[model samples]
Target chain A: MDIDTLSEKIVAGDRRALSRAITLIESSRADHRDQAAQLMERLKGAGRQAIRIGLSGTPGVGKSTFIESFGKMLTGQGLRVAVLAVDPSSARSGGSILGDKTRMEELSRDPNAFIRPSPSQSHLGGVARRTREAVAVCEAAGFDVVLIETVGVGQSETVVAEMSDLFILLIAPAGGDELQGVKRGIMEIADIILINKADGDLKPAATRTCSDYSGALRLLRKRPQDPQGFPKAMMVSALERDGLQKSWEEMTALTEWRKENGHFASRREAQARYWFEQEVRQGLLAKLDTPSAREAMQSFAAKVAEGGITPTVAAQELLQGLRD
Target chain B: MDIDTLSEKIVAGDRRALSRAITLIESSRADHRDQAAQLMERLKGAGRQAIRIGLSGTPGVGKSTFIESFGKMLTGQGLRVAVLAVDPSSARSGGSILGDKTRMEELSRDPNAFIRPSPSQSHLGGVARRTREAVAVCEAAGFDVVLIETVGVGQSETVVAEMSDLFILLIAPAGGDELQGVKRGIMEIADIILINKADGDLKPAATRTCSDYSGALRLLRKRPQDPQGFPKAMMVSALERDGLQKSWEEMTALTEWRKENGHFASRREAQARYWFEQEVRQGLLAKLDTPSAREAMQSFAAKVAEGGITPTVAAQELLQGLRD
Candidate 1:
């Protein structure tokens, strides 16, 4: 595959090319990583600023239903929508993974919408890395809206937050109050909270959940650049497609506000630096993952377990051996 | 200043020498670190498996009061108690830093109890590292119980959990239901839970909280080696010291069960390797923190921000530069 040709095709809004590019980036082959980098460089600034949205909730939170309706709503507005799900589960989620595709049958069939479930890889980091590169590829493919969906597990939630302009947390009505769903980790990161399944008898519960979440958000500190201050939350019934339009509007408005306030740019810049440092650590460790270093580390670990050497000292020795 | 002499003194239960050894270990100077490592080597296998109890809760959960009363009770039973606090606050904690001395007035006066407030430090890792070493010193000084208390913010709780034989989570009655505190991180690590302030008018609420926690713990899977098969919870009033004896008894029983089942040795061995890997990462990052590398990394970060380089590639390049 010629890197320049692939970049050009992706830039020209070819869905097949975008899919191929994502596949290339996700490849573990060294040559592929090199070509992927080249393709990224070539496609730099080729697309408009995308409305990057991060969606997350626990299993059974009606995430698929919400995304199907939400994606269809956006596509109806004549906007190109790209959905990338970062699936981290190796068990029990097989059903949900397939269920999502069947549930979103209409949206998946839409010409203006592109929906891709995560590949069956057990590594969460691999999924996150691919999802990030895929987000960029979708942008280059001229998708105006990129919705990255991840389960509300710790690792994926963190990855989604780092790569998103807006994070929307979806919750079911009876998950023991909105406060129960809201923990310190995701609570601090979420910009918009949506209490899903808010129709019929559950409407009152949803309203109370929204109010509870709103009250909780008030007590926490907000990002310095957010002019609207506290995170805004409301209830929605994705089954009825009610409140989907308002949620979309709120997301876009919040995004515009963040962009205007320079947070969007600053956050992106900071994320770039953050990933750079992380990769440096990972890249260095990759050297130690070699057979010789592994043996040395094992021996050093044995010595550490025997109590003759401290971990700090053993690590220093291993690093020295690596350096030498 | 000889490390051999210092180690001998600490092993002999010399409080002044133990305090001095801890101060030496906390020092950032290279020579002190070397000496501290030597001291640890000398004190290896000196203490007979001290009971390391990690205690944590949110700020207003009566941590100090609980520790004070609990330490007093243990000392009253002739068990030497050493309290090592990891204080995050810069404010009124200054008074508690002393207030602990005055507030635990009886315990402070007890020859069998040693209470030390945290040394003023901005870096959480530094504090954690020092606290870990301090626990060792306390153990060598013939303290059978080392209670490491940290506030419920993320990092400290994790550090305390890693170094502890058993983790005890202290919570007030009204801090939401039991499900509220049972998030992924520290919650999963805790072996025991105490609903503090469980006396008089608040007794019912504490009992409810305990039952709620017990129900929640049952819903979660336990470690295969946990003979009890679930984390136990109970109500206690620090003022009345009602459950202190039972809490200590539970901790000893759990520790003994884990030791017999091989979880204790395995966990310690695992922690040694965990810290070994972490130290390697930290030691390598320390190399980058140098002036020359910092300047080079800054230029690379600039290029990353300009989108000319991907963070993965930039990090790879940085690691290569360090190697070269």
Candidate 2:
């Protein structure tokens, strides 16, 4: 199908068209890139927006369970929900985190819900870029909420946070030592810290962990976008379906406050500008991806390692060669 | 003043020539850059080596005090020392952290010690690049050790760590809350953690803080380059000049082990390649610094912020315009 038809179908809330558009965006083929660009351009006129909540947690932190419960709650309230995962490690692990729909079986079967796994064969930057585009496609398809999930490791959280309006970090119940395991950078970006598995024997532990993180978050530098007493921690039990409503309320309250304070629109504008600059930087780096350029870089790297030339001088020579 | 003469003078340990070479490297002028490149190329033949140690700590963490005592000890042992500071905030703060040599007055007056403050007018990347080149000049000038100090805030620590053989993190004596204040990313890169002020009333507190960090360090993932029990935390009192020798001993032992195990050369090679790639990336980005390019970026950013175009589409349009 052409760009116009695909975009029209997407705007009409056709699930298959949205999926196809996402697949096109994830494609590395030259022609597919052109089509994806045109499709995105066509969808721009839709001007649909969604509550983008970026969620991240370590493996076994109950992300799938939490998303299923939380997403179901949104759908039950007569809202359309879309889930997109950004798993950079899937390229090396041979298994995407959300590749198995059974992990969120109930939500998968819900008519109001759509779930998409990560593209399993791209670098982190490419995956993030594609996921951001997929989010746009979802919004154009009239989704009320777009949940972006990423593994809470390395730089992926920062990348996910950039495309998201609100970033939620999920963690298991543990002591202060476990708190040390959390990346400081991730903590700085998170708007909320949710202690999952707050049911049965884990309730007290989860509560304590929640309070610990609340204290930790208080110590972090305050962001201008957040109102007073924000970036707080809450306890949730995905299995028991407890605290989901409260968490949702907190999210909505934060969203409403941001919207009222002008932060909502300004935050989106900043995110858009950030992505634009990122794309430009990536495009510039792409210039060095050719076979000859690779060969030249390899040769120069060897000389630099051998101490035959200073790194700056070697880079200047290579850049000069490129110019010539 | 010529490249050949400057290189000769630097190699002979002429302090004025070394200072002049660093000034040239730090210069943003087109002609100065060319001359700096030639001078660097000439100095590559000097083949001298220095122990490049990068140290960082928050303000009031006794960095100046520690460096003064440490530099004096090194000079007393008949080793020439060069100290370079990288302070990205100096541009806006109107005062470089090390601009006041009185902070290290004794070291400043010591004939065997050389101290240079931050450039005070460049971005982090430019400051880092210049400081790195200055390190090379110091090495060529027969300095036995080059110490790079950066304020332990923001991204400067990572930049300094990239150019150093070992990274040391300095902190004040405090409890677990203070531990939380340390950036996790900086902790991951640190080779040693020193809890300063281990004298007088703070002795016990300093010792406890050291043990706390020691436990924390154990929980971090083991690095392949480190031997067992490495990346440890220790207590130091810069005022009393205690623990300085032990810290130096550990640094030398780590450096020796790395050299014997081949990590030393490999790390430097990796650093050289890193710098070369950074220079290439920065050179590519410099293309957008033109007035017309800036205006174009502004217009596209406005469109992206306005929701009139997708960020990816706007970036593509701008990139296409560049190509045309």
Candidate 3:
């Protein structure tokens, strides 16, 4: 369909149209970008009145199970929810392949819930940009909540934390050392720490782990008004849906608190500012291979590589050439 | 000293002079940057003369102890060594006040060894930039080897990986679950995996963890070749200096292999290209806050926050106002 038709459908709150429009934006074709930008401009006023939550955990911490249970709980409360599971993309292919559909199979079938697994590009910052853009599409489609799942390692956790109003970190029952390692980074940013797989013999261990994290977090100064009202460590059995309701309630309360305060509005504004900077950076980099610059850089690069000159000097020379 | 004087001293292999020059480069003062860049240009001809190695691990995983033992091993072989430790900066003060001098008490006294712990900036990329710049200074000072000590968690590992030729990921004796958590993202990039504290009762556990990681790594493609050689996994008792010699020998072997194959030269060239892109991106972003742009953007931002306009349209409007 044409850009005008898609833009109209997206503004009218059509989910399929919104999804199609996002796919167009994700396209790398030069012409597609202009079309996508225009469509986005037309649908600019279709703002998401939805709450966005970010969830992070190391691989195999049952992030899928927790989300499935939590998504079900939200649906039970009659809230229309959307899930954006971000899969790490291959550096070579630059495509995510959207592998999360199989993990959230149950949630995907819910009519009130929309599940979209987008490929996380090579960099966390790139994935975050796409995810944020997709969330806007999801919001315009009238979803009440958008839950973003990040591949919880390296900078992805920070990227997710920056974009979401509420951030939850999932952990399992590994003792003190595991607790120590977690304390080093992502755990500090967590508004809520959910100790998953707290069933059978692991229940007691999960309780102990929760207490350890709670104590560890106390040493970390209170994160002045987290999206959530307070830092909480809760044990949840996703298989049995035990404590799922409590987790949902906490998430809801965090959303409510962020909205009532000025954080929700401020964070969105900050995210937009971040996106603007990223886009400019990306745009200029993409244009580095433009004919005139490429011709000037190539000859200078060859000389530097041959040991006739150093890279730093070569760069300065190239900048002078570009300026001239 | 003036830029030309500092550059001459560093190129003349004055270690103390080189250290002071690096401090000037890492300084945030605007004038210091101009001097540092000029110094870097002068020293470009003295590039890639040292083997750059990265060591990462959890705090208690004996990173400092391993480095001490390892540094002694290299110095014993008549090699002058320099260690650049990236210390976590205070989030509030943005200054690094870590007592690394106290941490490496013995090594600090070694005339053949130089240990400097630079405070990590708010951005991991910034730390990498300064460390790369420092490496150039150290190499020009006639240090045969450079070791970069990075904190294990978050983006620190990735940043360290990019800047070093050989990356050693230090893991402790946590079983399957912990291994499962780290098998992706940053850990997957390791060229060498060392299970530290492999002594006493922990020996068997350390051996098992090494084997487990080796098995998991088999699922990934072979570790990237260092200009020196391919990476490996080993068990080491940093306290006892057990396996320290083997690790050192392997590191040396890899460095030789890289030089002979010409991979070392090509890789450094690529790294220079990467750093150039990062500098341009950051430079452009700093310009985004020019007085007129900031004022116009702020007023447009207020409208976006009040829901009178969307961020995309508001940004365009602000840019237009600034241009006008």
TM-score winner among the candidates?
2
Residue-level lDDT of model 1, residues B88-175, one tens digit each, is 5523344324225765777788899888877656556666667777887898888989999877665778888888888999988874
- Of 1 and 3, the candidate ranking higher by DockQ: 1
For candidate 2, the docking band is medium
Q: DockQ numbers for every candidate?
A: 0.54, 0.77, 0.15
lDDT of each: 0.79, 0.90, 0.72
In model 3, residue pairs whose N, Cα or C atoms come closer than 3 Å (at least 3 residues apart or on different chains), thus clashing, are A96-A119, B227-B258, B228-B254, B228-B255, B228-B258, B229-B254
Q: Which structure is stronger by DockQ: 2 or 3?
A: 2
Ten residues in sequence with the least summed lDDT for candidate 1 chain B:
B90-99
True contacts kept of 2: 0.78
Worst 10 residues of 2 chain A by lDDT: A92-101
Q: Output the number of the DockQ-best candidate.
A: 2
* lDDT accuracy of residue A197 in candidate 1: 91
Candidate 3 chain B: worst-modelled 10 consecutive residues by lDDT: B90-99
Give the candidate order by descending DockQ.
Answer: 2, 1, 3
- How far in Å is the alpha carbon of A274 misplaced in model 3? 4.3
Task: Return the DockQ of model 3.
Answer: 0.15
Please give, for residues A1-324, the per-residue lDDT of candidate 3 as tens digits.
998788778767677887797788666676875676676666667655788888888778888888888887888788888888555544435654343667778787887788877644555555666677777777777788889887675576777777687888888887765674573567667888899999998898898998888876776766556743367888898888898888878877876787788767787777666655455445435434569877766776666556565444566666656546
